[model samples]
Target: MAAAKIKKGDSVVVRSGKDKGRTGTVLQVMPKEGKVVVSGVNIAARHRKPTQVNPQGGIDRREAPLAISKIGLAVDGKPSRVRFETKDGKKVRVAVKSGETIDG
Candidate 1:
């Protein structure tokens, strides 16, 4: 496997979709599926009937998985491409816009 460009907890911006221009933290990364679940982005609502376990089950709203290609790493509230760079004998993700290191 190669190094992951995007990981959990990474702030990212939606590149193309209904939620384009929206920025959020990455909650999960499914490398095998090439999808990612981002907070406050790509939300999906499911209408369900009441279940025996619980009482009300009107509409369930939650973040939906988005294709990995539809997002870019965010830096300072802006979207930017990421590239790996070796510094101090360690690999780090750097934003192309400001050339700043991205926090994990």
Candidate 2:
């Protein structure tokens, strides 16, 4: 599998989906599956059975994983393209707009 340009904690914008143009921080990355879970995006409700952790389990709202290709990195509060480069000895992915490395 190709290395994902986006990683956990990186801010991203939904590119093409029902949640298009929405921006959120990446909560998790499933590199093997080529998907990512973004905060407050692609939310889904699940009927949960009452458990010890949640005695009043009812509707559980959670972020659903979206395909990585559906998201674009957010730079300067706007969706921007990214490119990978090696600055010094470290390989870094930099935002095309500001040329700043996206924090992992």
Candidate 3:
């Protein structure tokens, strides 16, 4: 797998989907699946029919995984591509648009 441009805790913006253009922090990264879970985005609601596990199961709402391609690293409130560059003898992520270095 290539290097991860967007990691957990990264601020990202949805490129397309029902939540297009929405911004949120990345809650999880599933590189193996090529998906990511962002906070307050792509929420899926499940209605439970009351089971032994949960007697009064009304609804379960939570963030769902979105394709990594649907998201971009947020830079200055906008979506931007990320690139890696060697800085100070270490690798770091940089915003392609504004040329700002993200935390290493």
Candidate 4:
């Protein structure tokens, strides 16, 4: 699997697609599939079958995964590039703008 720069809870901005320019937190990451689910982004409706527990069948709103390449990390509310760096013998990722390493 390829290494992923963004992780869960990281803030990101949609670089392209219908949600372009929208910013949201990263809810999940799928490195193998090169997809990431951002909170409040790529929402889709799902039809549910009524079960004994629910009696009423309804549509539910859910988040859908989008290609990782379509999103960009947001640093200090600004879209910036990211790079991996080594500090004190440990590899860490940092935002290019502030040069602050993002803790894992």
Candidate 5:
């Protein structure tokens, strides 16, 4: 497993891919796979097989996992690199671009 800078609820912007430049919230993180699923990004359709949730079993559209390297964390409304820093004796994530604390 690897450490992931992006976590659920964090805002991010796609750096490269079909979704490039699009900003969305991080819905899930897969550090083991180096992938992260962003809401409203990398959408794909899956054909259902008539499950209880939907008897009709129509196609379902959902966000797909994107390579962790393909996205950048959004801080201060801009995409930026993330770094850890100690503030008031507590470690937190900091945005390299804006020098702002992202998480406490």
Candidate 6:
């Protein structure tokens, strides 16, 4: 997979869709699909059958994967675009809005 602009654990904001303006932490990144699963965003209900873990399986709510283009990285407590830059011999993500280094 190509290098990911956003990584797991990074805070992000939804730009569009039903969850627009909502913010959440990155839970998983699917580079191949260009999608991400953020906490508390794009939630969906899934019906489950009885299993060893839960005999009374019913409906379960969980976050669903969203297109990466629909979200932006949160920097300085706000949503902003990100760019890659070389800093001290290492590559890092930088926030365009605040000109701040995203990954420390």
Give all candidates' CA lDDT scores. Answer: 0.89, 0.89, 0.94, 0.89, 0.89, 0.92
lDDT of 1 at 58: 92
Q: Taking the tens digit of each residue's C-alpha lDDT, what string does model 6 give over 1-104?
A: 66899999999999898999999999999999999999999999999999999999999999999999999998766789889999999999999998999876
List clashing residue pairs in candidate 3.
Answer: none
Candidate 5 lDDT, 1-104, residue by residue in tens: 64577899999999998989999999889998899999999999998899787888888899999999999998666689898888999979888898988877
Worst 10 residues of 5 by lDDT: 1-10
Please estimate how well model 1 matches the true structure, expressed as its whole-model Cα lDDT.
Answer: 0.89
Candidate 4 error regions (>4 Å):
none
Candidate 1: C-alpha RMSD after superposition: 1.6
Candidate whose TM-score is highest: 3
TM-score of each: 0.90, 0.84, 0.95, 0.87, 0.87, 0.88
Index of the highest-lDDT prediction: 3
Answer with 2 or 6, whichever has the higher lDDT: 6
Off by over 4 Å in 6: 49-55
The ten-residue window of minimal lDDT in model 2 covers 95-104
In model 3, the runs with Cα more than 4 Å from the true position are none
lDDT of 4 by residue, 2-102 (tens): 57888899999998899888999999999999999999999999999999987898999999999999988997777776889888888888888788777
Range of the 10 consecutive residues with the lowest summed lDDT in candidate 3: 1-10
Give per-residue CA lDDT, model 3, range 8-94, as digits (tens): 999999999999999999999999889999999999999989889898979899999999999999998999999989999999899
Report, for all candidates in order, the number of backbone clashes: 0, 0, 0, 0, 0, 0
- Deviation (Å) of 24 in candidate 1: 0.6
Colliding pairs, model 6: none
